[model samples]
Target: MVLLLLVSLPINIIFHKVKLPSVMGFIVAGVVIGPYGLKLVDDVESVNHLAEIGVILLLFVVGLEFSISRLIKNFIPLLAAGGAQLTFTGLAIYGILSYYGVPQNQSILLSALGAISSTAIVMKMITDRAELETLHGQTCIGILLVQDLAVVPLILMIPLLAGTAEGGSSSVGMAFLISVVAVTALVVVSRLLVPKALSWVARYGSSEHLTLLVILIILGAGLASESLGLSLAMGAFIAGIIISDSEYSHQIFLDILPLRDYFSAIFFISIGMLLNLSIFIESGTLIFTLLAALVVVKIAGAFLSAVVTKNSSRISFVVGLRLAQAGEFSLVLAKIALDEGIFEASQYQIFLIVSTLSMLIAPLLIQGSSKWSLRLFGAGDETAEGPKKSSGSLKDHVIVVGYGHGGQNLSKVLNEIQIPFQIIELDGESVRRALIENFKVLYGDSTRANILVQAGIMRAKAIVFAISDFQATEQGIKLSRKLNPDIHILVRTRFAREVEELTNAGADQVIAEEFETSIEIFSRVLREFKIPSNVIEQQIELVRMEGYGMFRGISLDAENLRKFSTYLTATLTESYQVSGECWANGKTVEALHLKALSGAQLIAVVRGNEVTADPDAAFSVVAGDVLVLFGRHASLVKARKIIEIGDGACEKS
Candidate 1:
């Protein structure tokens, strides 16, 4: 295992750096180290044992991410796209096999194996592209779920198809019943016991206990499934689904991810080890012929399914290509069939080569399929639901990079004040969110020059790099400057050290998170000390000047600067709503004397969205009134606490 890691890690990393999928690298490493090449690991028994556990864990993680609620909600695609994809793909293969004089039972089994698409590959592609929320992406996931469920039936049919199991149809039905019962039991146990157990264990805050418990549950469920004469992976998936909505799901994911990735590499490598180079070399022409046929059939089936399901021709084509590959389950089924003497050794070897090669090339195909489809289909727009964009006349617009928190706030204020602005967000989901808010957001990498141009960077008044990724920010700043040298380039960096680098990259102002955070901290301290506003302003300006002139373009006196800086400080004029039953509700302003009690002066009382500025001391503080108060952090907390106290409850106590 250690030696396998030694070869696999560096190779995968190298492959990833070259824009190739890491799985391919692991497979290559496995092929080189396996008996056929170096004889380092003569047999795959130990690796396959570990590999099975890896597959279980991998599927478990995937199940955790895929909520059952999501599956139910997306049932249309599950039934429509999934049924079409599987039926059409299977029929095509089965027909071809029958034409070649293959037996009915073997042909049916082979067609079933060929029809299943790789959930791992397609899911990874969608995740990497940040497109899980897209129409096509969701469709793919729903169909994949149906197909995964179909695997149980397919596996059951294997023994029956081979005529080796007793009781025939009854035995098959029994296998499915056991699987369903085991899964239900696992879910019930998880929903009832796991969350309670996790909560109890979490209170102690022991990482060791939390991690151990998670591992125990994963393995326990897997073993239980196997004991019930079902696949271990099936049980682990059920366990993951049960824990997905638990409070500790995120933590459990964090705890188990590294192991999943590592073992996943081993799993793929073990797959590669199954290949015999001599056989593949002898059957290269035949192997390529079958691979091409498989690819064409899978793509056509998926595309037709998606099209019939009302997905755009372009989207359907892209999705078709995305899933045009034999999945890991297909390999598992083929191997099982070979072991049961349902497949000849030569036939199994051919299937292995086809499956491996299909998976190897799937990522690359998915990457380029959109562009390929757009060219072939000549669809008017790339996205069916994306926002309509016409940036031809965009000018003097503020360009905000990243649609995250800071960017959202900036864009919100810009919209409220009627300032024209455009957002550049790489995440398709984020872009969709921004579009929902009516922001003119484009979905593409801001680091790309063309994408920036699409955002009207050349004609924009200023560009704000609000994203946390420093490298991408720096590259964007450089490119933006080259495009519009006079455009005000403002950058936000997480570190003070990067400020100078950002300035060098052509950013006019660089606000480092650490530096600005310190300013906020000290300014609050000064406010608490009742330091003169002028002195604090000078201090902040001096620091900013020394740290790369971050707070620029604002020429303000102490008072105006103080007002602006208050927005950044913890002590500010913030509003607190007085709910019914609160102690302060129905009380007179003089009776409460909020300024005296909490050191928070209520400047305005807003009732039913009507603001009474500087209401008299006798003004009644009624429930549903929003009190805009000004005070330090501690005073605000105290004021909020008083407002939240039930009417007369405190006095009665």
Candidate 2:
């Protein structure tokens, strides 16, 4: 493991720096370390299992992030483009294979494989390029999502098809029925049982417990599908959809990230292991032919799909070219077909060769799409009409930089409140959607001065830097301040240290999400201990005030530090409050022998508005006084009974 990491890590780092997909590095690493090369990975089966895990996790995460509502909203375009692409590509490939004299069954299997593009590779590339939220990105992702949804049925049908005699009936009636029934059962169980089960586990308030529950749900669902002779990926995808709306979704994603990365790496490495260099070297002509066929079929299908969606020729070409690659899932399909005896060994080899080459050339095709689109169309031409210019002054309008989740939410609230605003988004799809909704949105990057001006930033009352990229946020702040020195800039960030930088760049307020979340978690912990509401509020206020902007640098005085320490101690105790009826209630500290309560320490007595700190032995306890005690969790629970519900020694009043 150490050796593999040592060899692959540097390559990955270099690839990332150069802005190339890391999958390329993984492939190269695997090829170099495999038996045919340096012979580092001798255990082929272990490596293959690791790779399979990677594919599973990759699909699992995709399912988790799938937005069904968004997909349904754009259903017409997605279905139209996706269906056209798949049909045309499949038919084109099938015809070509037949012309080349390939067997009927093998040709059909190849066609199905060709009909799909790599969701894993394409998504990674789009995300790395920061284009997943862009117009082309959205269109590509939407189409790919439809394809993924289709793969589940394809996997099931492959086995049935393989079992049919040559030239016999190709009836898929039974498979379809079973599939529908399975889907219905999954939906019912997920809707009725999964949420309640998850809620019960979540009440424990343990991160570990939540993580375990999430994994169990995913794996359980996956195994259930497998036991019914269906694809595990289908089950995993369904599981993702079920949990996507849960509060723990993001946390679950974070928890499973390590597993995803590890498995994905193995998946790529396994692909590398499968490649036979000698086969390629000996059949150069065949390899090129297969590669050319795959590319042409994919591009043709994508282009036709784009046209059907009402896109212009230029837009269609760009979309087609961007999607002209066989993705990771294609390989999964090929493997399944091969295992089911749907394709001969030689045919499977050809498909793998074609798929890998397509992936290798995908980056080049995508990189040139923008420039090519402009050349095909006209420079500076908006496919849809540009936003209409305002007839009156643009002053007092809010300038929103980014139309993502946070930006969209803010815009919705602003609209409800009747606030005029101009939104600037770099993504084409987001801009397109906004335009369709008749929103005052500009398609451009806010970091650029010209784009900001186009969005009426100069006359804006406040600039909301809602973009997640920190460097981009800083740039926007600097540009906005330079253009309008008096404008208020509100920036959102994930780190506290970014506040100072943003403020220095002329931001009026910087909201750090991580810091805010941490404070919220701390507050909840305090509340669980039954701390007085006012005390908790005061501590929170102090933390927020001291933690924001320049005040973060100043050290607290001794008195304030002591106070903070005391609050922290009280917050950590699980159950430190005792009811009035407890044996220790109305008993002086000396009389109760407070030292005997393991790990317990009395901090103060809250009697109405006055607080008694480190009280003397004569400090008599009042019935209504709330005792502030600190101790280990178990000790705190025992002490809580004395101050809260009271000990069993209480008599009826």
Candidate 3:
């Protein structure tokens, strides 16, 4: 284990710098240090043990992320898509292998292997690219969830496929039934005990105790399942699902994250150790040809699955490309196959090599999927309901380019005013949300030129880039400006450093979160110090006019600071609402003698929107009247007390 880390760490560092996935790096590290390469450590038993733990942890985390409620909620739309994907992909692989003289049972096992895509790799890549909420991302997740669930049945099939089950078909069916019963019982029991136990630990135990308790639960569940003829991975996953519905699930996930990552890397490394490099060198052409065929078959199957489930052409194409690799579960099945004599040593080596290569290529495919999808599908709107043709009828309208918080608020304001506007969002769920709210929203990547054209950017009066993806925002700014030279482009970025870059990319106005937050902070501070509202507004206006330069480290001129200081210290006017129980309510201005009592002049009294300015002393004040007073800060403070509680508090003031 120590040697594995020493070899893997530097490789991972270099891989990170080159933008390669850490999973691939760990696998490569294993290949280099395993017996076939450098012969650094030939003993494999200990590594395999650690690798088993890693796989269990990996599945546990996956289950934690995939709560039962999400699975049920997404079932209606995603079920057909996910099921079709697994079925079609498996059938295609089975057919191809059978045509080549592979035995029926071996072909079936191999097909299962080819049907599942690497959830770990695909998810990590999409999350890094910030596309996990996009249509294709959601589609991939749904399909992967189906694949993960399929692993159990696939495992059960292994004994029957290898002709090793004592009761043949009946045994397999009984095993499936037993597995289901065990999962249900585990969930029911954990649901009753886990939450209360966690709550008690949180109330009375240290974090270390909580951590240890969680580990105990995970391993104890695994051991229980193993004792009942089930896989440890299955029990860990069930444990995760049960805990996911609890309030402490997120905390548990965070606490176990380091262990999960550590074990997961070991698992992938063990996978790489199983491959024989000599076989690859001897039959390189055959292996490459097989890998190419697998990629094509997987992509085509996934694409058809999406199309069959009524996804738009763009989303379908992208989903196909995104799921073109075999996953960790594939390795588990392959190992079982090897043990059952479904695979020879060399054949297992080939499978391992092909699977690793496919995983390595998945990230590149996902990163370029949007552009490839646009080219293939002609940039049609990919909405949750299906493709909708873009209209050019929208003229001089605001185009909000994301459906997140900023975009949602902007759309509401535009709708309230009855302004012509359209929204372009990539997130399928957000697009659905916008539709539910009756907003005109188009689902597609705004960074793509065709998506921009489809949104009628040529006729847009203004476009707001309200997305958090800075790269996409910059590209959209440049593309929108090119399409509509006269249109206003407003952009919001999270960092001050991005302001100059966005401006150079043709954004007419850039709002940096850093500067805006600082501006708001200072404005509130000024309000607390009794600066008049109008004066604060002027300061805010001036700050914006200077492009937030003052907050960005551009020094304010001495004269301006002096003027600001003067405003802070000058006599100011303030308005106070008269409550029914106030001392000044129902009192004549002359009788109250506000000026004499508090040394603050009553500049005006507003009654039901009628203003009595500089009135004679006979003017009467009433409840609900707004009193406008002019005075120094200290005098205004004293006058407010005199108005609130009569002359008894006036002496204290």
Candidate 4:
């Protein structure tokens, strides 16, 4: 165990720095320490046992992340794209395996494995690049979600395919039905009971006991599923989904993450231990041949499936490459086949080699998709090429730099308002999409003056640099200024610190998303006090005027800090509309004297379209009058109580 950890930690960290998945690093460490390699570990049995627990735990976490609600919400994509992708990919692989004279069961297993992609890897890349909400990213995720759901049934089919005593037709049928019932009961019970139980534990149990409770739930679910003749990992997944629906899911995920990552390393390494250098040496040709075949099959399968679902040819091709890699679950499936005596040592080694190679290269494929899409589908031009054509026909258009999330949203708004705009984007896919949507998008780096001029920089009403890359945005700002000094320049940056830097770079209006987002949070916090929208807007403007410099290096002294806090938490003025059925509806203002009882000052009585400010003692409370009351939170509650149920609900008011 020490040797495994010692080897894995450094290797994983180093590979992670080099932009490769840590799973690869752990697998490499395993290969180096295995008996066939360095003989550091004579046997990997104990690690595999630990690795199995990791699988169940991580799958449980995955289950928590993906609930049935999320699945059903994406049902359209699941049925249309996901279902098609699986069926076509499986058919393509099954046909090839059968042609190569593979056994029926083995071909079926391999085909299913070939059809799935690594959800973790793809999602990480998408999120890191901030593209999870993009059409391509959303489509990929929807399909991946469905593919993950498909794993449950694949595992269920394992015993049936293996033809064990439990795999008899009637027995398998009964087991399947029972497993479905068990899963339903588990989800229902979890929703109805897990939260209450956890709340009870939280109230009485120590932190350690709470941790033990979570582990027990995970393990208990696994045991239950296994007892019902289903996959323990799948049972754990169901348990995870139950917790996910509960309020405790987030805490449980945070608690289990460290254990999950450590054991998951061991899981990947177990697969790596299967890498026989001997097989590579003797059957190098055949192994690479199989590797090439695996990539081709998956890429083609994804592409064909996407095409059948009416995804554009360009999107289908790129999406196909993104999903070319075999997943971690594929190894799990392969392991089951190996343990079931369905695959010979040589066959398992070939699948293992192919799977690893695919995973290692999948990241690169996703990262380089823009360039590949350009070359493969001719959807866009190289960045060196400026605008495909002159935009002389359009006058005073908005020029958007970088067609990422910010640019996309800005362009969408502009297009909706019938504002003339042209986009300068370096990403081939973004350019293709823009053009497809009938926008005047140029394929070039905006930092280039020539590219900017070609995009009508001189005549554009405004130039917006909306990309996340700071250096690139700075360059674009400087270049735009040098060319058209009087142009309206708006720059969007990620960090609060970038606000001053971007402003110095000559932006007319600089929006720091981080601080602006903070403003939003503070605004919401303020609104909870019933502070008016106009006040919130004023506070947000104040933050912007100061460049939200507090986030950078600006500091408030103790007195001023207290003053600001007081303003933020000051007495709020709220208006309560008088209802006809209320006991205080027709009472005299002197009798109700709310200021004396609830410490709430009636600032105004807005009756219909007229306002009577500071009503005197002779005034009568009437229905249809909006009493604008001003007070601290506690006083406001009393004022509301006096108004809601009359003076009877309040101690004095």
Candidate 5:
């Protein structure tokens, strides 16, 4: 294992730097080291097992980001586009196989395999390009999800069609019946049980535990499906879909990502191990013919489907061209078909040749897709428009990039406070939501200068970049600072290592979620151990003060530290200040009988520079005093009205 890692390390590095897929590099390395080449690794089974883990992790993360609500909203297009693609592609392949005089069972299996595109490769490519939030990307994912779901029945039907498994026709009938039952049960269980189970797990707050549970679920589901005469991959994919709605999905993805990377590397390597170069050299003409036929059929089907779904000509062309490549699961289906005597060895060889060539050429096809699309759709006549003007003036308004969870939460708070803000989002659905909510949101890429200008970055009070991609966030910060140096730029990051880069790019505040979560967890642990609250507060303040200027040269002093501490404690203690209404607007704490009715103590009142500490019981109330009160939870509730009604009065209780 160590040797394998050592050998593959340089190849992986080179591929990454060259902007090529790492899995492609892994396969190349595998081919060089396999029996047909250098003969380095002989145990293919172990490598395959390792690679399978990567597949699970990849799919799990994909599921984590799959929003069912978004799918439902675009269900009609998804069904139309995806269904048409599958039907046409399958039929086209079937026709080709029939012309070649292939057996009926073999033709169906081959056609089904050809109909499916690579969920793994397509998703990885989209994610690498940082285009997963775009309309085209979402459409691709939705179509891929439908295809992945279809693989379940296809796998179950394989054994029956091949006559390899027991119970004959009854087995085929049972398999179909069982699949329907399983799918329905899965939906019901996902709706009723998964959420509660995930919630319970989250309450425990152990990421490692959650990750282990996810693995178990994936493997367990896969095994169960296999026992019911279905594909393990299908089960794993379904398991991913079920957990996609869970709140812990993100964390689950993060935890399993490393495993997925390792396994996917192995999976590609295993694919390389299966290839016999000698046979390819001998059957050159036949291999080339099969490959050409596969690409033509698949691309034609996808293109027709894309057009039928009402996508732009360019989008349809790109989708068709991109999906011409055969996928990983196609190999599995071919193997099953061969083992069941549905396809002869030569036919299997043809399948392998076509699939391998398709995989190898996919990147090139994708790269040329835009050019091809332009040719297909007349140049300069693309349907998609350039950036549009924002509703409001950009001056002094907050510019928010990325309308993800963190950005959404921030927007909500800003809305409540009536702060002028404009959002830049790539996702069409998110952009639509923002517009419907009467927000100043523009659909554009934040990394582009024009997009930033459209969002009013020049005169913006602050720019909050909550994009998940580190590179994009850094680029946005750099551009925003160049556009307007005086603007306050806040960035969100997943790791502390990204903090310095964002800071160097001119971010005023770099909020590292993981770092913050760590601090929060440690603080909770301290509290659990019965640490003194004041001591904990002091420690937290000290750490913040020391680290404050490390990124942006801002520091917290004693006064500010005290204020933060008070704010934290107030929230922790559930004590809040509510403004006084017309009835008690002019009354002092004593006159209002606050102590008697609410059992609350007035700690201090600040009116501009005047700080009245522990005012007398008979002190007359003023309209504009900023109240700093300390009280029981029930007392704070009773005093809510008194704290909310006064003019120029803000709560810091």
Candidate 6:
């Protein structure tokens, strides 16, 4: 265990710095330190036991993140695009392997393994680029979701394929029955009792206890499945799905993440330990051939599937390239095949090297996919007149990108004010919603130059990007600026850190949710303390002019700092209601010597809806009178103290 951690830490860090996935680093570390390389760790059995736990935790987390609502929401892509990609890729590999004289069952297993794409690498890259909400990102994720589900049936097929079971059909039927009963019981218990148990634990248990409970649930499910002759991973996955619908899913995932990473790393390293470098060196040609076949077949399958779902050719091709590699699950399936006697040592070595190479270059493929697609298809379907042409010729209009909350609100105000506006949306569901409301929405990615042109970018008065996808927003801003140099561009970002980058990308104005939320909070707080509305507005304007610099710890010049200090302490009005217990219950304004003591003036005094403006020295103050004082902040504080107590209170201070 110590050896695994010591070897993986620096290796993973180096990989991370080089912009490679840590999974690859772990695999490489395994190969370097395994018996095949340095012989640092030759006891594979002990490591494999720990690695198995990693696989279980890995699948458990996958289930926990994959909520049922998400499945239903993406059902179309999951069924249409995902099903097509899987069928096409799997069939192509199967045919190739079968033609080479591989046995039927072995071909099926290998093809299934080859059909899967690396969810870890692709998700991390898209998430890092903030493209998860982009059209192609969603399509890629949907395909991965389907592949994750496919693992269950593949695992179940292992024993049957290996011919290790006793009664053939009867054994299979009995096994299926047991599996069904076990899964049903697990779901029922999770739905009916696990939530209540979790609630009780959360309410009364310490955080440590909560952690232990979740760990128990994961391992207990695994044990139950193993006892019933099912895979531990399958049982844990089912448990995760049941808990995913509950509110505790995210918290549980967060709590288990450290363990998952640790174990998953070990699992990958163990797979590396199985590698035979001698075999890899001898079969270089075969390895490269298989690698080429894997990429081409997967890309073709994914591209065709995306096209069948009506995705633009550009988006389809990009999605295809993004998924053109075998993933961690493929390694898992390969290990099972090797253990089941389906793959010879030489074949496993070849498959392992091919899978590792595919993952190593997966990020580059995804990063270059857009440029590749554009080169191949030359603007593709984005140039087609989508909803933009249907909206008719528009000029001096506003172009809104992403029909999300910001876009919707902007559209509503534009309509009320009778301003001409057009919306460019990429999400199918969002586009449908906009069309339902009779919005002049173009259904395409705004990052495309042709899409911007179709939206009257050259003639539009302004363009606003209210999308959460930062990469798309940045790209759209640059494209819009390139299309129309004079058009005003506004961008909204979730974090203030992204403001400068978006500005550099040609956004005329950038509003960050973080700083705006901070400003709103401080504004409300000042209002509660009776600060004048005009003064509050001034503070807000000053902050905005400085680009929210104050909130982000940006240093201000002495001149600007002095100006802000003056604005904050500038003379302002603050009203204080006189109480019966106050010292000024029956005193005249002049007799109180208000200005002499606190340097504040009693500008107005209200008594029973009768207000006295610029009260004279003779105006009397009493209980229930609302004294409106005007002065600097410090002066107001002193004046309020004198009014509440006696002027002697000010003298003592």
- Per-residue CA lDDT of model 4 for 210-316, tens digit only, reads 77898998898888777765566767777887777777778888898788777877876775776678877888898788778878887787887777765555567
- Candidates 1 and 6, the one with greater TM-score: 6
lDDT against true structure, model 2: 0.71
Best by TM-score: 6
For candidate 6, lDDT tens digit of each residue in 1-653? 89888988899899989877676778788888898989999898898888888878876777675555555577776667887888988999999989999999889888888899977667656655656556787788788767765666666777778887444645544555566567667667766866787789989988788878888888888897777656677667767777888887888989988888788778778767866787778888888888899999999989999988878777788899999998777887788888989888777878888987787668678877876776665332343454243335888999999887788999999989999999998777778889898889998777777677788888899999988766567777877887789999998888888988988999888898889999999999997775766778888877776777888798666877788689767637788999999999899887777789998888899999799899888888989999999887767877888898878967886
Q: Model 5 off-target regions past 4 Å?
A: 1-6, 13-20, 41-54, 64-77, 87-111, 122-137, 152-181, 190-216, 227-230, 241-258, 282-324, 339-344, 360-402, 419-428, 440-653
Candidates in order, TM-scores: namely 0.63, 0.62, 0.75, 0.60, 0.62, 0.76
TM-score of 2: 0.62
- The order by descending lDDT is 3, 6, 1, 4, 2, 5
lDDT of 1 by residue, 525-592 (tens): 98777554555676787667555343533455666457556645644666888888788888888877
Ten residues in sequence with the least summed lDDT for candidate 4: 373-382
- Report the lDDT tens digits of candidate 2 across residue range 446-468: 65556676777667899998876
Whole-structure CA lDDT of model 3: 0.80
Predicted structure 5: lDDT: 0.71
**Which wins on lDDT, candidate 2 or candidate 3?**
3
> Which pairs clash in model 6?
none
lDDT of each: 0.77, 0.71, 0.80, 0.75, 0.71, 0.80
Consecutive 10-residue window with the lowest summed lDDT within model 6 = 378-387
User: Model 6 — TM-score against the truth?
Assistant: 0.76
Per-residue lDDT tens digits for candidate 5, residues 1-653, read 77577767888799889877776777777777776767788887788787776666676666566665665688777867888999999998999889989888878888889989877677766665555654556667767766765666677678878776555656544655676577556556655766776777778858767777777788876776666555566567667767877777777777777777777777776767777788889988988888888888888988888777766555666788778878877787778778777888987876776787777677667656655664555232212564344446656889889887888999999999988888988665677788888888887657666678778877789999887655556667887887778999888876666777778879887777756776677779877664445546666655544443423345667776787677556552332322444545567566666665556667777776988888787776666666665665545555554445432222432
Question: Which of the two, 1 or 4, has more lDDT?
Answer: 1
Error of 1 at 553 (Å): 24
